[model samples]
Target chain A: AQSVAQPEDQVNVAEGNPLTVKCTYSVSGNPYLFWYVQYPNRGLQFLLKYITGDNLVKGSYGFEAEFNKSQTSFHLKKPSALVSDSALYFCAVRDHRDDKIIFGKGTRLHILP
Target chain B: GAGVSQSPRYKVAKRGQDVALRCDPISGHVSLFWYQQALGQGPEFLTYFQNEAQLDKSGLPSDRFFAERPEGSVSTLKIQRTQQEDSAVYLCASSSTGTNEKLFFGSGTQLSVL
Candidate 1:
């Protein structure tokens, strides 16, 4: 089974400060990791993914995530937080053995101005 | 269509009533998926279709939940005897391939069962 976990239910950060939303996973094989963001009443939008290459993957809206195989983690990060960065974030994982993508319980990010 | 589109953006159904949700994927997308998202939770995979073939439905909660993507384009999810637990945002997504392609999602249909 492939599973992902978002340890924090909600994260608060001040504007201009760096923010991190933590995520970890469990998979028997190599994991394909992804990050998605969702605003109220809107569908989730893809942020970034890690398949096989670089440890750090940059995504939309100045967001990025680092894939750590040893830690089984793929934490979402931002250099500096903005109020507009507030949204629900999800970590997902899929392995080659299954076509289904499993998502973690979401983390709500709040960037205080 | 420019993106995956779902119909009945909001639905209110009495318990035991049946409802059908519709999804229109982007043109030429080979993979379509249905997911159920409860409040404050991530999207839970319900089913997957490749073209017109229903491949994986292991995530469906019950036999009352049914889905089909005939003709390899538009898809429909039918729920029989709606229950309060079934109230959630049903999302539809599509991708160019069945592999590791990023999914394009719809705004989702919010189903409220009373």
Candidate 2:
């Protein structure tokens, strides 16, 4: 079974600070990793995915996540945060052997302006 | 529509009632998925459909939950004997193909069981 974990339930950052939401995964084989953000009253929106190739993956809204194979972590990051960037972020994973996409409980990001 | 659509947007059901949620995936999309999201939690996979085939349903919490994708276009999720615990947002997502495809999610049906 594939699973994802977001260690922190909430991550607080200042408007102009760099922010990172941690995510780790467990899978039998290569992991298909993705990050999604859910805004208030909106559906989950796809942010970025790591299929293969470069360790770093860039996504919408100037968000990026780095896949660290050695640490088994895929942490979503942004060089500079904005107040509007605050939202519930989820880390999802799928294995080659499973059809279900497992998601982490989620991390609530708070960007104080 | 260009995106996945689900209805009714909100459903209120008394305990022991049955509820049916509908999903209309993107045109020509080959894969569909159902997930349940409780308040303050991320979506949990319920089932998956490949075209007209119901391939994997291992994520379903119990036998009371059933889903079908007929004609490979429209899909429905039926919950029998609903309970307060069943109150959640039922989300439907679709992808062009199953493997490694980025999923497009619908707004979802919020089911409230009293």
Candidate 3:
């Protein structure tokens, strides 16, 4: 079974400061990792995905994620945070056998002004 | 015209009532998926369909939950004997063939069971 873990329940950062949201996963084989953002009462919007490529993957809204193979981590990062960037972030990993994607609980990101 | 769409943006059902949520995937999309997201939680996979064929449904919470994609275009998720625990936002998404393609999501249908 494949699963994802987002250790933090919530993360707070100031506007214009760098931000990081941690994510880790457990899978049997090569993993397909993804990041998605969900605003209140809205469906999830895709942010980025890491298939097989360079470690750093850039995504929408000036966000990026680093795929660390050894650590089993795909942490989302942003150079500078904005108040509008505050939302719930989710990490997901697709199962190799069935292609069923499992998502982490999610982390609430709050940007302080 | 290009994105996935779901109908009944909000629904309020009394306990034991039945409700149906609809989804229309993008044209020519081969894969469709249904997910349930509780408040403040990530969406969990409820089922998947490849065109008109229902391939996987292991994530569905109970036997009362049912979904179908007849004719390979529009899909519907029906819940019988709705319970309070079933109250959640149901999201529908679709993607083209190939493993690396990103999924396009609909706004979702929020269900409130009383």
Candidate 4:
């Protein structure tokens, strides 16, 4: 089976400070990784995805994630945190053999001003 | 119209009552999906439809859950004999292709079973 793990339930970062939200995955075949953000009382919004090439993938809102094959990790990062970046972040994976995407429990990010 | 649209943003149902949730996908989207999200958890896949075909229903929790996209544009998910465990946010998403690409999601219908 395929699964995603987000180690942290909540991450707090000060404004203008760098932030990182960790994610790891397990899949039988190749994995399609993605990041999504959800604000309170709203639906999830797509952030970025890592399909094949370029381990470093850039996403919306000045966010990026590095895909490490050996580590089986895809950690979302931002150079500087903003108060508006506070939201729930989810890491998802889709196995090549399946059409369904599985998501992690989600990490709540709080950017303190 | 501009994005995936779901009806009845909130629904309250008594135990043993049946409820129907509706979804209207984006124009020309070929793939639609239904997901259930419990409190503080990620969305769980309930079913998938390609056009008018019900391609996958493996993630459905029980036989009481039924979903269909008759004309291939709008879809409905009906739950019979509602239980407290079934109380969650039912999310509807769509993509242009059949593959599980970047999906556009609706605000979702928050269901509460008493």
Candidate 5:
């Protein structure tokens, strides 16, 4: 019943350029959203979460995400991309009543130097 | 303290064989979870344990999958009758109590079914 969609499978960006990876969700109740990053052959690391906070939530590695309740969207953004930022990005949403987290398909980000 | 740790970083199992994956959570974490992640996809929840209690097993794909946390600190996930579809990375995560807590994940065991 609850799910998240990441429209793009891959996102390409140049170093020093701003980047955005899109995410949207469908849930029955209020959403507790989060973003995580995974490097090749490694476990996912938490990036940020939005649980009843300002529209824009800042996270690790100079990354941030904007939570738009009306759009049902939580797109991860970075002011300037770095080569080290290239990795798989996942968007997850947890319903208020359930601890089960539904994650998006994930986006592979490539930051070209 | 150390973060969540899962072992045998890699496992190779023949079809129909059984395998066990282990996870050691942070010393005081109360919620432990098991998830399966296929290549290029997000991790899918398998089971959850609150301390030593198996509070949720709804996400487990089949009866062949069993998980337990006997003492509430370490847990193990056992899979039987392994199939090709069973090949994936098994990730374990843990968090403090309360539904909103952030999850800390382990490097995971990469299971390759032959």
Candidate 6:
């Protein structure tokens, strides 16, 4: 079985401060990883993905994530936070065994101005 | 071209009633999928279609859930005998490739079963 875990349910950050939301995964084969963001009452928007690439993956909205193979981690990061960045962030993994995407419970990000 | 489109943004159903949700994928998208999302939980896959072929329905929770894409461009998910447990947001997504690369999602239909 394949799964992803988001250790924190919520993350609080101050405007202009760097922020990180953690994610880890367990899979049987190659992991196809992705990050998505959801606003209240809206559908998820794709942020970024890691199939096979450089360790550092850059995405929309000035966001990026570092894929660490040894740690089995893909942590979303932003150089500076903004109030508009507050939303629910989800980490997902596509299992090679099933070819289906498995998603975490999601982490709510709160940015304080 | 428009992104994926789902209809009946909100629906309320009584127990044992039936409901249908619709989705129109982006022009020329070859793959379509339906997922159910419960409160505070991630979306769970319900079914998948490759063109007009219903390729996968492994994730559907029960026999009451049925989906079809006869014309290959538009699809519908029909839930028979609605139950309280069926109350959820039904999300529809599409990808240009059959491998489900970078799926584009719709706003979803919020279903409430009483």
Return the top candidate by lDDT: 4
- Cα-lDDT of candidate 1: 0.93
Model 6 DockQ vs. reference: 0.66
Docking class of 4: medium
lDDT of each: 0.93, 0.94, 0.92, 0.95, 0.92, 0.92
Instruction: List the pairs of residues colliding in candidate 4.
Output: none
Please, what are the lDDT tens digits per residue for candidate 4 over residues B1-114? 899999999999999999999999999999999999999888998999999998889999999999999999999999999999999999999999977679999999999999
Q: List-wise, what DockQ does each model earn?
A: 0.77, 0.80, 0.66, 0.78, 0.73, 0.66
- When 1 and 2 are scored with DockQ, the better candidate is 2
Clashing residue pairs found in predicted model 5: none
Q: How far is A100's C-alpha from truth in model 2 (Å)?
A: 1.4
User: How do the predictions measure up, each by TM-score?
Assistant: 0.98, 0.98, 0.95, 0.98, 0.97, 0.96
DockQ of 5: 0.73
* TM-score quality measure for candidate 1: 0.98
Which residue pairs come into collision in candidate 2? none
Write model 6 residue lDDT over A9-99, tens digit each, in one string. Answer: 9999999999999999999998889999999877899999998879999999999999999999999999999999999999999865565
Q: Indicate the residue-level lDDT of A108 in model 2.
A: 99
lDDT of 5 at A71: 97
| Candidate 2 deviation (Cα RMSD) | 0.8
Model 3 interface DockQ: 0.66
- What is the interface root-mean-square deviation of candidate 3? 1.6
Chain A, model 2: TM: 0.98
TM-score of chain B of 6: 0.97
Q: Tell me the lDDT of model 6 at B107.
A: 96
> Which candidate number would show the highest DockQ if scored against the true structure?
2
Report backbone clashes per prediction.
0, 0, 0, 0, 0, 0
Off by over 4 Å in 6: none
lDDT of 6 by residue, B1-114 (tens): 578889999999999999999999999999998989999988887888989999879899999999999999999999999999999999998999977768899999999999
Candidate 3 C-alpha lDDT tens digits along A25-98: 99998899999998876778999999887999999999999999899999999999999999999999985556
- Comparing only chain B with the true structure, the TM-scores of all models are 0.98, 0.97, 0.97, 0.98, 0.96, 0.97
